[model samples]
Every structure is written in C-alpha cells, then in structure tokens.
Target: MKIINYREVPILRQSESPAAGKIWSAEGSISQRRHRQTRNGDIDMAVGDSLSMDEYKLTLASPAKVVPLDPNLVLPKPTPDIETAKADLKRAGYAILTDVFPEELVRTARQVLADEIKREEAIDESRVAKFFVDPDAKNRRLNRLPDRHEVFRQVLEHPVVLELTKHILGPTVLDESYLVHSVDANVTRPGSGAQFIHLDASNGVGHATPNQSRFIWCLDEFAEENGATRVVPGSHLWNPEIDPTGATTYESVPAEAPAGSLIIYTDMLLHGTGANISENRERASINFGITTPWCRPSINFPLVLDPEVMKNTSQTLRQLLGYSSVMNGGDYPWESAPESIRSLCVPAKMAY
Candidate 1:
C-alpha cells in the first residue's frame, strides 16, 4: 500500500553489493530496515533496505517509466546466418552475440546509465500499474522507457534476434517487440529478484492454443551470482502443472552469458531470475515477445508504438509484433466465403 519512486527502492546497501568475480546466494527475503526522519523531512535508510512509505507495503522509486530504446541509433552486428542462429537457439533457450553492437554504442549507453546513477535523476518513484504489476510483490514489475530511443529499438529489432524468431516461428514472422521490463542496479536487491518457478502463461491462461515465443536481451553480462535468469531445459514440453515432488526433477539452470546475448524460448518454458547476491553491480535486460497471429501478446505492443514506428519497422519485425493476421487451411490468393458473410467477418492472416 506504500507509494514510492521505482529507482530508490533500496534493495542493496553500498557495502553489501556483490563484487564482479563471484557467485552468491540472493534467495530469501531480507528484512526491511527502519527509516529515520531528519528535521528537514528527509528519510535515511541504507541501501538494500526496503523503503516502505507505509507499513505492509513497499515502494520502488525508479528513475524513469519503462519505454523501448530506439533501434536506429545503434544496431547490432550482422548475426550468424539464419541456420546457425536457429541451431543455437534450439539447443539453448538463448544465444550470445559478443561484440554485437558497435563497441562505441554499447559504451555510450552504459555511460549514460552510469551518469544517471551519479546524478540520481533517473530514479522513478511511481507505483506500478495494475496490468503489469504482480499481486505478489515477490514478482513486481520494474519501470523501463519504451519511446523511440535508438538503442532500445535496435535491440528490439536486432537482426540476429529476428532471424532466429523467423526460424522458430517461420519466414513471415512479425515484430511483436516491446519493453517487457528493465532493472536498475541501485533498485534491485537480493531476494527481491524474480525467483518464482513458473511460466509466463501462469499469470493468465491464453486461448489454450500454443503460438507465443519470448526473446530476452542481455544489455549487460548476466552471471549466476548477479541474478542471471535461470531456466529449466525442455520444461516447455511438460504439462502446465508439474507436481512439487517432480519440481526438483526439473533442474533449474542459469542462463549465464555475456552482454548482447539473446535468449529465445517458448511460452511453456519454466524460467525466473536468480537471486542478486552481488552487492556491487546491477543486472539489466530487455525482454521482447512474438506470437502467432491467432494468439494474444503478453504485453500490448501495438498500444505502445505509434504507426510511424510500426511502418518503419521491417516486415519480419512487424509480423513478430502481432500486426498481421493469420490465415489457415492454405487459403491463398482468394476467399470463397459468401459476400454477406465475408462482409461481416474479416479474414485471419497466418504468420508463417
């Protein structure tokens, strides 16, 4: 019930931050330290402590609202040919492209982020909206900007990522990309990381049809100790509910990789972020998704992007974004429905 900025949530203390060279346990909830009010009304609490504006509710003071970074400003290097990208994606839930973006672009973006941290101007304190926020604070959403920032857009439409999407989804794939979420180094703390053992679909069941896929981009290196994402291989093939006794049978493995790596997996895959035990650094990433035309998106991408942005995007990108329709039964070039019926119902286009 507390309201606060998203960036200033105080999850890790300056001294307790994780170091650069090791793995550590970030599981379990850390207790919230009490806040002391100064005469001028300023509140003081160490880092990694919860900032509750009120009891029973914690607030996250993020710097800016989440939005997509622009794709045109900084493009990733040409990905491996489609076939190679496909093979890597299939074997592992994700793929890594070292030195993907122009080294300068990556350096600049990181510099901007670092400067923001120093200025303390990037902290967003807004309460998470209902649609995106999880009922359990354990899985709360973080703020990320999606406006036409070049880096955000480039990553969203990265060729390697799209090529692989096409391999799994088909040649006619569209760009169903958007800013799924972003984490600030200062705000994310140990245990506050997403550690739930669940699929993205469990939040709300889709049409009982299978057509969605997710792509995760690591803007920074993700290691096992710094809350790198973890996935259970092949769990996407399991039934929706895996009994607790069998839960342990489904081994949880970390999706560790360097910056510029992309992890693509089906909606059925079981995954979550490992705990952030490191007291020194933050883990940041961008998550995008694409589904068949018949299925709905986990995030509303169309609503976020304008027509110009959509129009400028590649055809493959648009298809993955869910802009096109789906056609079934090999019906091509013509429709045989009666005039009256055809007028009442629009045809569905398939994403091959």
Candidate 2:
C-alpha cells in the first residue's frame, strides 16, 4: 500500500507562499525501512511507490434497435405522497412524485434553462447538439446545470430529493456517502428517436450494488405521445448476467408525470428516453445524479464552479459539491477555513 503525507497537500499547507506548497515527486519507490526501521517491529511501509492501473474489460452489448413498447406492461404510477413514492422506488426500481415542485418554480426553471442554452449557443454553438441516440438531431443536451444558473442550483437542493439520495446511497462511518455526481438537462424535440436502454451505474458488473441515483425534474409534462422516460420495472434486482444489448427487445413502460414532478431511479435500473412522436409537444427534464463520495463526478465542480456562486451557496450545497469531503484520510484545512464554512471541514473525527 502507498502512504501519503497529509501535510504535503497544497491546500492544507500553512503558508500561502508559492514554495510552501511545493509538491514532491520521485521516479523510484521509497521505503521507511531504509531510514528508521533498523530496529525490529517497526512497520515496513511503502511511501512513494507508483500505483498500477488494472483493466477490467466487459463484453460489449450489441447496438440497440428502436422497438415498440409493450402497452400491456403494468408499472408503478406517480404519487403525491412521499411514502408511496418511496414504496414505488423499492418495488419498481423507480418512482415518480407529482407536484413535488410548484408550477411557478417549474416555469422559472424552464425559462432559465432556455436562457442558459441560448447563452451557451452564442458562446459555442457546438455546445448544444443532438443526443448520440437521436440520429435525426431532434434531441438536445445541456450539461453542467448547476454551473449554468442559480435556478438549477436551487432545484438541485430539494429536501425530498436529498432525502431520497440518502435513502438510496446510505451513509458511511463519516457522514452521508453521496455527493453530487453531475447535473444536466435533456430536451426531446418532436421526432426525436429513442435512446438505447442501459444502466446508469457503471460498476454493475456482477453482484455489485448501485452506487449512484438520479433525480429527474420535469420541466414539461411527460406523456406517452411526448418523450417520457421509459423504464424496465424491477430491473435493478435482476441478475447482472442477464445483459440486454441493443439487439435485445425488452418491455418498457413510460414514466409519465406532470410538469414539476420528480422521478427517482437507481443507477442499476435499466432505462432510456422514449421517442417523441408528438407533432408540437416537447419533453424537457433536468437530470441530477448523486453518487458515493469515492466516485469521480462527471463535472469537477470545485475546480470549475464560479467563485461567486461558491461564496454565496449554502452549506448543504457546498457539502454535496465535495468541498467538505475527506479523501485519503485528509480533508480541507480548518485554520484557514472561513468561520461561515468551517463546520464543513470535519464532520467526522479523523482517527489519525
């Protein structure tokens, strides 16, 4: 095992001077036995050893085909109560909670998304493009939602959603194990094609459980005619060996719900976007993902987030963004931390 010196972390260093944060790198491995372990019973520790990366390959699933849905399939329906929604999540691997957000809030979020998309288009038209599954170029994806606008950040902090996140991910010895994985928006325009069915959890190789969950905030009413999300109910509990490829045909039901509804699902669940067949109606949803703290988030919020937004955000939001997260037995510095945010520095006592 490789041992890292916590003091070597630049952000935790006492001095602000450039030299004080100097990083040490060596080509050869260093062992503590060379210096202090001339005496017996001293632990032989590898300090500067290079770690090797292991490759675990998978049998690639074949390309999926846009197939017709089985209308006879019965699945969980949307509910207004939290208990029922939670029950549905347990039973079907997904749940839809209606009226979770006020209609006005949904409207504001839609407007904000539109404005942000426009701004992004102006900056780089390539930023907005059709989903890979949408060959006709009807569907569009907007990435990094929280970094785009305050409305997205506000919606991402919904208490109910956070509660569900905690429920799904559970807690570690330190604190809540989950952190913000990513936030994005998916817009399915008319004639948009169906997406390939897949699992959100990349680690679902064999018996491994899901380490991630998602919150899909509806910006527009989802209907069968429009592009509602389609899911294979109870698929999360299915044996991992039963891999469904693009060529495979599986029964799926639309997770239809009204605007302002929230859809919760685990990464192990097999799901995809339904094709939009409506002439005028469009389907839009803001997708937020939360995963265990050990997982690398899609977006590096700490490195890329606007400083102004970071300065004014709430403690929960900061924690969710991984600001307070402990890595390799070290966390953010306490002494240099502002009084307003110091509570986040150490939620769990470090054993060392």
Candidate 3:
C-alpha cells in the first residue's frame, strides 16, 4: 500500500482532488490505485471546458431574483438552547447562535488572520484572490486555517459545535467514524461580491448525500446591508427534480448574527456568501467543513500538521485530523486496531 502525503498536494484539478487513501482512477478503462490505503471517491466540479465553465457559478444571475432577509432566519438564536435553532435547521436548513463565543476568542482569531495577511503582504502576494483556486475570482479567503494557527484548534471540537456535527454528520459508512473535510476562513473585503448558493459536498455537480456540514464562526457582525450569508430555509429538503444543475432561483434569506455567533448548516442546505457592501468594513469569519469519514479534505491534516503541533494536540483533534484511523477511516473495529494509530487514539483493550 502506498501512503499518501497531504502537505505537498500538487495543483492537479480545481474540482477533483483525490481522497487520502486507496482509490479507483478510471482513465480509458485502465484501473490504477490512487493511494496506498486511506479512503476512496471521486468529486469533480468543473463540468465543462474553458468556454462552458458554468458549474460552480450558481450565484444569483438575475438581479430581479434578489435575496430577502427574514429576521427569524437571520437572527442569532443562541445555542446550548438549540431547540429553536434545531427546528430552524430542520425547516430552514440553517441555524445561528448569537454571541456564542467570548469576545477575546473572536479578537484573537482576527488577529491571527491579520498577522497572516501581513506576512503575505511582505511577499507582495496578499491579494484575496490569491487564496482562491480560481485566480480569476480574487476575494479575501484562506484555504487551510488549521495548518496556520492553533487559535482555531479549540473550535475543532467546541461542545456546541460537536453536538451540531454529530446531530447532522452522524455516523458515516463506518460505524462511529467521522472526519473533517476542512477548516478554513472567509475574510472578505469591503467590495467583495457574493457567490452562487452552493453545497459543501464534493466539488461534483448533482444531488449529494447530506453528509457534509459547515459551521461559520462570525468574527464580525453579519448585517443585512453587508455580506451576511444567504440561505433558502427549506431548500435542504428540496426534491432532486427542482434543479439538478445545482443552480438556484429560489429566493434566499440572510443569516444576520453577532460577531461571536456561530452559523451551522447542513451540506445539503443551499447557502452562499453575500457581497460585502459595507464601504470600508471587512467581514471576517472562520468556516469549518465537517464531512463523512470517506471524503478527502481540501487541506490534508496529516500532511500539513506541524510535528510539534501534533505532539501537543488533543486526541480528539488528532482523530479528526485522520491520525487515529487504522485503515480507511477506521474500517476495522476498535478491538482489531492497527498499531499505526495507537499513538493517536487510546485503544480499548479488545473492547469498545
């Protein structure tokens, strides 16, 4: 089996990135092993060539089909007390918890981002668009936040966040195995434009399993006038016949929340970023993409994690990062564990 390295992933495809483990690659009837032994699947987003590239551009194309905001949908409903928010997620596809974090934490995250930007500016490549895979769409964003700072480390398993993930992400193909797809940030500039409402599932186009979920940590208050996120409350439950193209004509409501609030939504839920209309203010938020045990994260943790960081990180975080799995996402039972991950997880003695 070949071991896959996550850190040095080359720029191969914008939509399709091979998963972390043993995978199937069909190129002209020839079957080849993609990795030694992790997980397997294929997700491609660019459905068309250069001229017909219209898959990931599902943003509002018609100005008349503008998005409207509902106070209930946008307001930070507050969590731990999530019954109301839970109902909203069930009915509206998203729920927001206002002021869920301490002001200090929020400030620290922003500071971390600012420091990164300063470092990038030193190299004269700090343009927001630079972070996007598509260089054409230059906006303020970061791809791999976990790789850069530990400030985000705690959020990896924030109690409320974990509960939300377990409630939605649930069990994967494997019994109790789940994994993180990615942990990134969306730091938008004043003039940043909105994106097409989309799902966080594979980059592929089509109806996907409701296995992915996104948690947005709003570092800045999301106002109606500014770029608050847009969502179709009940769109997560929409029939596949509605729009197979992944395009959306459904009107969206804004998710207005406090700076320290958290916005959690399912992957099947239709959502997108709103344009930062504030004249001079920037919208700063960190996003965590939690996926099933079988998917590949945009930024592979095993490869990007600093040795020192890994040494000090909690077992919970380490498991989410993929070091705790024996085979392809813990396919083997706990009793039949592999020694490779013994260091990552406390193996139960032939038991649960």
Considering summed lDDT, which 10 consecutive residues are worst modelled in model 1? 1-10
Task: Write the residue-wise lDDT of candidate 1 on 204-307 in tens digits.
Answer: 33324234457666656777666676665544445434332111223355667676565566556656665565767666666656555445554554445555
Query: What's the TM-score of each model vs. the native?
Result: 0.54, 0.72, 0.70
Which lDDT value does model 1 have at 332?
31
Query: Model 2 over residues 1-352: C-alpha lDDT tens digits?
Result: 1111111001111224476675422222232212122133121111010121100011112223333333453467778988988888887889999877888889998998888777877897667775443433667789867667778888767788778877887765565435788888988889775654556664643645778878899999988778788777777777464343223335566788888999999887777777677999989999889887777877767666655556777767776776665554356465764565454343322211
Model 1 spans > 4 angstroms off: 1-85, 91-99, 108-124, 127-145, 171-191, 202-210, 240-249, 306-352
- Global CA lDDT computed for model 2: 0.64
Ranking by TM-score: 2, 3, 1
The candidate that wins on lDDT is 2
Where does the lowest 10-residue lDDT sum fall in candidate 3?
1-10
Please name the candidate that would achieve the greatest TM-score relative to the true structure. Answer: 2
Q: What is the C-alpha RMSD of each candidate to the true structure, in Å?
A: 15.0, 18.0, 12.9
Model 1 lDDT on a 0 to 1 scale:
0.43
